[model samples]
Target: MSKKIREKKSTLFSLLFIAAVILLTLWSLSRAEDPDKLIKDIQNASPVFLVLAVLCVLAFICLQGVVIWLQCRSLKLQESLWRCVLVAFHGYFYCSITPMQSGGPPIQIYDLKKEGIHISVGTLIILMETFLFKVVLVILSLGMLLFGHRLMRRYIWPGLFFFILGTILTCGIVVLIYLSMFHSGLLRRLILWLFRKLEKHHLVRSKKGRVEKLISAMDKYRAAAGYFRNQRKLAVLLLAVTMLQRLAYFSTTYFIYRSFGLYGVSYWTIVLLQAAISICADMLPIPGGVGITEALFQVFFRDIFGTMTIPGLCLSRGITFYAQLLFCGIFSIAARVAFRVDKSRLGFFQTSFIVPEDAP
Candidate 1:
């Protein structure tokens, strides 16, 4: 772990990452089916219907912004909920376009900093919000897997048990490490000993450090079980947000199917359709899930569409993916320009920024 060896390892890793990026870029471009057809699919959306869909998406983004703002305020930021919502919209617009579902926070952080929030607080809020979001997603996913989806309902009881056990075990390990390494003197001594050795090899430097500064700031209101520690309540609220998101979308799909003359589709059918489409689209990993999502809807609804599979699939996918993505990008541009969000581009979380010494 000397400087020379570290340099060599870094170079090797960089080369590997670059090679992987090149492969992915190529694989993605080569998979593009037809430019004209994609255009048609997006344009196939009626202007009026598309406008309505866009409004729904806007509402979705605003709700997310509000929740994030509330969370930040609870964490002691002085930003308005409305401003936060606009930032959220801009962030989602970017995350939607990029792979790994990243983007949204850094831009908002920069904007908020201009409005007087310390950059460090902005960064902290993003991390906290993301942690809450993920916790909610996992809980909701577990619920859906247990009782919501028919496929899951059949085989997932045992799977559910195992999943819960796995989650608990993971949490136990993490808590153990946190308690032992950071909060316990004996464990802290062991960690420091290791760090010194590693430091000699130029791996980790500065054994004497107050790592708890970050942890204590986040746990600022732990005595009152302030917002940061109320993960369960936050998870519930975020679960509601997550459910609203899924419900609005599936309901829209049901309406779209009706518009297309597929009558009498049940509530469960919509859930099934949305779940199947989402699971498949997520696996694709392409920005917006593009071709993968469309193909999924088509395959899932093939029975309903009969021989008109392609158009039927495109119709559903259009409402969910291409159309929504286009509207998000357009609205994002409008919101950014209208509200003067800096950078014109942003991401999910702010990784670095300044902080007032006494803010926390």
Candidate 2:
């Protein structure tokens, strides 16, 4: 499909999801006793704490931008800081709208290519970024599961199902990434074998051509992985940076909690819970994990949030999820305007074989 048509579809899908979220939230609020009072309670929340909570969310975005900048510097790519920020926002825009946040990478790579980075390098950068983020999230999830199993059991029931599923999903991705990075040849062989079967059964065309292209792409990706492996210190530093990025997101709950005069709960405890909530929410195939996320918030924090539970959900989801959606929408336009992104350069979605790269 053409880029224009694809963009229209994306816009429509995003609007639909936004509408669903708004309607769901309203429906939820309508069921609450004295919905106006709940709004009033949220409105009465301290502006200072609310602002801090937003800043934390922005920090999370900024840290992602920093990751791109650091990766560019390491690769000697000539992308500017502002462009990196824009790319981060662009990724978030697509991620928030799509199921399981799956629409992020292609547009992100396209944006990087617009900034004059080679597509191959951009792909590797994003792959590493995603890998590191998931690794940290999984580690945090496991740590929380191991240490807080007893406390978590109180909220187990349905949330536990999602939690387990999310962990399994994350672990699956981690394994695939490991294979791609360290055992690319084996990955390439397995993929080729699968493709051959599909072709044999008339499931795909261009069998030989596609297989050759796939092998080429895997080689490029493996080479990129090797580059990072050789830069061991830089790789380690990026891992630590990514961990902080995750923490910044987790800390959003802490600020929101404090905003409501809800205190005495250990921040780390909240962070752990936030990690679990995130793990479960991320696993769901919902746009922004909208309903699931809110439900998880209520289930996990009911004891601490008590009467303020609804308001707390409103604030937390507002700042971290919906607010970022709005931010990405506005900033993405601004970035495109500032960068003068060419219409033709913005390609529509397609899965292609990665070819050999030239210098950026």
Look at candidate 2 and tell me the lDDT of residue 102. 77
Query: On residues 140-182, what C-alpha lDDT tens digit does candidate 1 reach at each position?
Result: 4555656666644443332344334434543444455334323
Residue 327 lDDT in model 2?
95
**Local accuracy of candidate 2 as per-residue lDDT tens digits, 1-360:** 998898889869876976878797768766974788888989888889889889888888888888888877776555567778888898888888888777887788877766655566678788788888889979987876787776677755458888889999998888887777767678768888998899888888854477776766676676666677788888888899889988888888888888888788888878878888888877578878888888888889988778888888888988998899899999988867766433433322212333324324
**lDDT score, candidate 1, position 331:** 65
Lowest summed lDDT across 10 adjacent residues in model 1 is found at 345-354
Q: What range of 10 consecutive residues in model 2 has the weakest lDDT sum?
A: 347-356
lDDT of each: 0.52, 0.79
Displacement of residue 171 (Cα, Å) in model 2 is: 1.0
Clashing pairs in 2: none
